[model samples]
Target: MLAKFRQIKTSYFKLLLLACLGFFLVSLTLLFIPLYISFQNSIVKSVSSHSLKTLSQTSYSVEFMQESANTVAEQLFFNSTINQLLYALDYNDIDTIISLNTLNSYVKSTLFIESVYIYSSKTGNVSFSSKTNGSGFEHIDDFYDSDYLKTLKANESSRFIPFPRITSNDKLVYSFLLPSSRSSDLMFSNSIMINISAKWLENTYKSIGNQQDDMILIIDSNGVVVNQNAYAPVLADLKEDPMIVRILNERVNEGYFLSSMDGEKQLVTYTSSPETGWSFVLLTPYSTILGSFANLKTIIFAIYFSIMICGIPICLIVTKRLYVPYSVIQNKLVDLEVRYKSNHMVEKQNKLHALLVFPSPFSESQVLQLKAANQFKVRFDQPYSMLLLQIDRFADFCDQYPIRDRALITYCIQNISEEIIGKVVGAESVQIDRNGVCMLFNQTSELQTRLTPLVKEIQQTVRKDLKLSVSVCVAESGHTIADASQIYQTARESILNKFFKGPGCIVYASDETAKKRAGHSEYQPARQKQLTDLIMVGKFEAAKKLLSEMIENLKDAHYDYFSQIILTITLELNNTIQLLEKANELTLPFQFNTFIAKINNMGSVEELLNLFFRLFDEMDAQLELKKKSKNEKLVQEIIGIIQRDYRDVNLSLESIADLVHLSSSHLRRLFKKETGSSIADYISRTRMEQATHLLLSTSLSIANISEQVGYVNSTYFFTLFKKAHGITPAEFRSKYATT
Candidate 1:
């Protein structure tokens, strides 16, 4: 065993291992010593502070309990039986024995009293006792002859004396004294005794003691232990403990004292009872009080050992792999942060002034803000008009291109808009999805002053680059941006104006104002009445001439309503022209450009008459062609309806003629001329078409379809359907309706 021990101790390999182990152990100890000391000190301080807090709490609790007991005693002393005894002392024949028995029963049932006594200093009368014989207190005059009685007599008031021995129960009692008015001089002495059970005091002490492993005691002013834990021997000799003696001598209400008790150093914290003149003391052992810090030191040592054993090797391995990437990322991050910080102050200035360049959606809050900021009044609130311009053949352009190229085209259009408006007006705005731009100006004067050059610029730029024509519609001034959406709708209507009046033009709301003021002109009210009568009779040309004369008068007079009257006439002319074109497919060479320019320049009735005559001639030609085509289409539609319905057995040339409101022969001839076939042949073709549709679309057999199409014979229906469609019914069904 000795040789083996030496081998284990002296082996070179093992010595190297032991050396490493010792080095680690020394390093770990040195590292952890300061931590352990700090942890230990912290725990000690925490425990000490907690103990002091608990001491204060316990002291307060003791005082509260004592006050509660005093309240109970005061309530008991004022009982009806006790009050009767006080009143009955003045009457000699009041049967004091009955009252004393009543008081005894009252004390037993109502208060937690062992016994109660009423003592008279003048008559040396002690009327109550718990003893069965009632002989113990009969001669007890000197017993009540104490300093407390003297003090009570001197003060002529109530006094509470705690922890007095009551011989009736052989236990500590709390006594209350009130000067009885029935005394010989009404001043000497009055006293009351309430012998409380010692078990109650013991139970209160036990309650405070059970909160912690501490010794708790209740002691009187005379250095006797009234209530204390049975295991605490230090409290048995109160005279030997200077802290207790000092407490009694000093009569401090509350404090802490450090002293030796039963040869062991301890802490004593005490509080005096306001009700009973006794003090509650808490005694704690020093070593036990400080033992709570051990776990903290152990935890700190464990943490230090873990760091020493595993931390360094792991850190070194991780650092070796991470150093390069981490350094690169760190340097990049540092550069980015520095750049961001430096550019932060300059970024606001670099933001593009897009507010003026983009059209704002008219939201109520934005309008309110504009109003509040006075931007609306200052910028757009005056007699400012709106112009909404849209591209005419944009859809055709998009449909002709690939999606990517379409997007590029749209981008180019936006670029063109920016360029044109940016150069001409100096104030440019755009709404892209709507494919339009809005131009606001003070009035028609501003628009005409600024717009001619701008429109020329736009026409030149779009014609050169995009080869697209542009149409514009201008709304009269005095509307806000909130009404910009309505203006955009009006502009859409104006695109049709180009077709009615001719292309490449600008139209204004004022162009429609003339019709609104037709008969209101001063000259020839009779002519105006004649014009109304002619329009009612559908003599549109005569009415047109009269309206032209009225517009001429307003223009020559330059009346306040001239713009209004002219706009109305222009609107009426545009509508009449559109109607004529739709009915006749007529073409007009008159351009809206001339009308807009003439309206912009005309200052007399003769110039207005010239424009009106030009408009009327174009419209009359359109109306003549519209009437002819309309009559032809009506005749052809009647013939098609007759052919479709002739297969019904109830069908007749008369009914078919009636459906188109014509005589049977006339319908017959019309059908023949239009279709190059007789009515009977057309009916057969119609039947074949219905048969073919049913055969391909339904599961019904050929015979049923034949009957449904007014062909009685299935064979004939099949023969006719095949001749008309070049396929038999079964073949047609197989080709188109295979399930």
Candidate 2:
């Protein structure tokens, strides 16, 4: 036995098998045992919770129905028409008509109400309204469920309790009785009865119990099954059932228990509603309740055994391949260490970028990795300052260089920054974006006198070496490493307005502006309105001028505010053009979506302004083209109307505009644009020429000639004719109309 044991210990396969078996046993004990125990407990809790939730839902539905019925009853009780009808000793046909209409409206408006009935014991009058029958007056003794009055009188305390009733039409409804007043006059008081739909209640229960073995029911305090999902008849006594007897005897408001019903063990949950004095009960079979959990347990056991059978041999094979001599492993590890150190630079830059750009606390493991790599040669324990170097005219630069050239230029810029800033202080630099590189270094007192000048030097060197200008934004005074990201953000935002400041400029972000940036820019609605109007009128030059003014005004604003203003302008302009397009005035000149995308990719405010001008020019040309084609037809139409209506006395601008279906002001502009004269001038010219012809060709008097020319005031016509031909009408005829 000792020889066999020694051999087993020395054997790799046997030892591997033993280890795998022990690990499987220990893992199953630690993980599956607690999981199974918790699952067992949870199955019971889950079943009870699910059953209770379903019961509560059903109870809530019943309560909602009850409340709806009561609301209808209250409306009838307070109704002035009903009140007037009830108080009158004799019925006015008008009051009865209005009360019936009012009750009909109440019944039709409420979803749960099958009908509404109003009774006056004093006058022995009855009025009822239903969904099927509009409304009518009936004798109190002939009304359906008229005996409910006696029941209401008997139970004076039951103000809004519902009683099940079968109507004369053979429809089952739950009727609620509500008196007009709370005064102790039940014997003679008027009352309103609201009947809730029994089918709707049953449907609510049916929707809750979708499973075949599930049964839900609503029982009143008297143990009558008022509502049920089963085929059993409602209003039947369920108190004889053992489950119901036990639930009532327990007297708890809500609870669940296992019980045998219909010769099958089921989980029964019940909840009592205080509003309606009804208990909602749900019974789900025990097997169905635990069915999913039992399946889950079986799946878990199958997965466990399958892993044990499949994992052992695979693990052994993999371990056998991985096992090697110690010397060879040591040599391979040494080679891997060299390769890891060689490739860790990029990873270090990413880590540094995260530390500076994302303001999150680092873990100890992360800090230790940085310490071990130690490639960037920067320390985070001390205070630091951040700088953002953004390429000036970045869009132009991208257009000028290819991908490789751009990358090379970026590398050169970083190298220059490292050489320049690192000589003065401990520094680390990383390219954070395509056009921007960020640098962090130890803070010094000479931030303003020393570091600022060095940043300017770096900017100049980049411009000189790479022929590309860069704008450098330096953050505020010394800040802790934790606050590096905040300062970096400030610096980054400050450089966004490089178009306002020229290339190769060094700007410092002041603490005050950094805080003030949080404030919003004042929306210039007046200027925006002016801009929109100008664009609509096709005033390209004026719109361009206004855009320049806007850009200038917003030069000192925060980038967020400026970008929002630009977006607002685009949205408002697009909306206006869309409205015109809807009116068939003109189609959109440019694709608005593509225009907006170009605006977003713009590198500077000038680029944005120029793009706006381009859009304006396109829109202006479109408007001009449309105007030229559209105005000529409208103007000729106007001329024809003037010549035809010259004999009429009311040939005015507004009248002609109505004929042409144009606004008076718009017609005036259009005619002037086409004829180079006013509508009034054209009318005068037409009438005066006719007056001249009449004077020359016919033997008509001046007043007759004036009347023939559609002039009601002859004096005004003569004065206008004299003004036109430099003479009176007769003299003009004598001078120019003679043969």
Encode model 2's per-residue lDDT on 1-739: one tens digit a residue: 9989768655865665566567766886677778876786577667777778887887888788888777766556545566555556677687678877777777787777888777776677677788866688676777665555565566445568877766767778887877643224435556777788898887876687556777887788878888645725788887887777877777669988888866777877788988888887877787886777878899878877787778677767754654334666899999999999767867777887887678855654566567566665665665667788988767778889988999888988989998998777878888888998888777767654688779878988887888888888877645445676777777877776565566777777884365355664577889989987887666779989998997788876777677888888889888877765544333556667888888867767777788888888877776776567556656776888898899998889999989989899988887887778999898989998898878888888899989989998999998998898889887776787665
**Tens digit of per-residue lDDT, candidate 1, span 1-739:** 9999768655743444555556666877876786676665565455444545554555555455445445644554445445444333353444455566666664556334555566655455555645333412342445432433443444455444444443433444444443333424544544565555555555654554343657767676656776536534422547656787877776557766567877887766666655556666767776665577667667776787777778556544544444235677889999999998667423321211133233444455655565475343223444455555556555555557776875565556556755665543334334434345555444545546776567657656776787766666666555555454555555555444443233456666556443333434455547655654563344767866677656545543323455655665555556544544434333343546567666755433555566766666655554555455445665666666756664575655676777778888877776676667876776776777777778877889888888888877788877888887788888888987875
Measured by lDDT, the strongest candidate is 2
**Cα lDDT of all candidates, in order?**
0.56, 0.76
For model 1, what is the C-alpha lDDT against the true structure? 0.56
Candidate 2 — which pairs collide? none
* RMSD (Å) per prediction: 44.0, 20.8
RMSD of 1: 44.0
Candidate 1: deviation at residue 384, Å? 70
lDDT of 1 at 580: 42
